[model samples]
Target: MKPHLTLPIAIATALALAACSAAEPPAPAEPPVATETPATPMPADPMPATPANPSVGGAAMDAGKDIVTNASAAPNLSTLVAAVKAADLVATLQGAGPFTVFAPTDDAFAKLPAGTVDGLLKPEMKADLAGLLTYHVVAGNVDAAALTQQIEVGGGSATLTTVQGAILTAMSDGAGGITLTDGKGGTAKVTTADVRQSNGVVHVIDSVLMPK
Candidate 1:
């Protein structure tokens, strides 16, 4: 009876050991294999466009201000500024519209028939003065590239309609210089090109544009 009891006890112990082995916690799943994902590459920087000609009239053109405000900075444009004020065009130019102005220097105004500017400043001649001023402006901002492309498209000449409803012609005046022909067949050579303003662009012209 004692030997039979010993054998049964040993079998029970062996069964308990098998159950404990089966219940082990799966060795923690091998810690998920530690996979390392490669990092994404960063994009390259963009190349900046070439800058246009330097600002005109010994001052850098301010892109943050409107055409009128920027034009006021040019020492050579004082006469043009006075004419603009007298003609009441400051508000119009300061508005949201993007107007292209062929700005004339003081020397350009001097080229006008003597007393022409004085006469235009008169109260009764305001309309005429405004017309003349507007003639120098186009409805949209016309940059140097656009002007040159238009000239090429028009077989070496481009006709731009001014804000005053007059036609002005643009043509290459030899060696990459541009000349604008007004309604009266007078020409204004662009001494400086691409004077960027906030609301528009300005090309400093050697002569003021006149409308018929």
Candidate 2:
């Protein structure tokens, strides 16, 4: 009993040979720790996708967002956005109600007459290029302060009526701005008018409107 301290039998044979040299089989199970994969979500935006408005080959279609959207017109009329897409007239200037476009920028087709905007963007003259572009449209809704008070009480003048019906006058250039005769007289001045659309109004003329 006094020697029972045989060191607890030499520490239980050194803890059974150190648990059989730390059992080498337990390490192979650690390979299950590698996981990372979860990321993908971004895509949704495109309709009339708005880079601007107007359709059909979209040739600068900027007739004041089709007169503010009266229905869908867009003939920013100049030498004609490539003759209104070569006469397709962008779905009849976006059809539906109230149309009043006097637009014409790009320096108003650079004041044509020289090859008249490439001869009305040829192609059998697309119905004379959409009848000289719906003769600069005018089915209704003529704004711009009632066209500058009807061109100052008619002294300056202010008449309109097209859709091919013809009869566009709207003059008044003592400085104020306004001019748009066409029925073969071809004038165009407006040089930027009301430009409100959604029903019609763009008066940004300069020239390029002849139809008689």
Regions of model 1 farther than 4 Å from truth: 1-40, 47-53
RMSD of model 2, in Å?
A: 16.0
Off by over 4 Å in 2: 1-26, 46-96, 103-136, 139-161, 167-181, 193-196, 206-212
Compared with the true structure, what per-residue lDDT tens digits does model 2 show for residues 1-212?
58877998899999998999897466555567778887776776655643343332233445445533332334443345556767877666665557777766656677675777677687987787777778877887776678789778888787777887778887777777777778777687776565555556556666668767
lDDT of each: 0.89, 0.66
For candidate 1, lDDT tens digit of each residue in 1-212? Answer: 57879988999999999999998877655556687899998988889885753576787778778989888888999999998999999999998879899999999999989998899888888889999999999988889999999999999999999889889999998799899998888999999988887788888999988888
- For each candidate in turn, the TM-score is 0.79, 0.30
- Which pairs of residues collide in candidate 2? 67-197, 67-198, 68-197, 68-198, 69-198, 70-198, 70-199
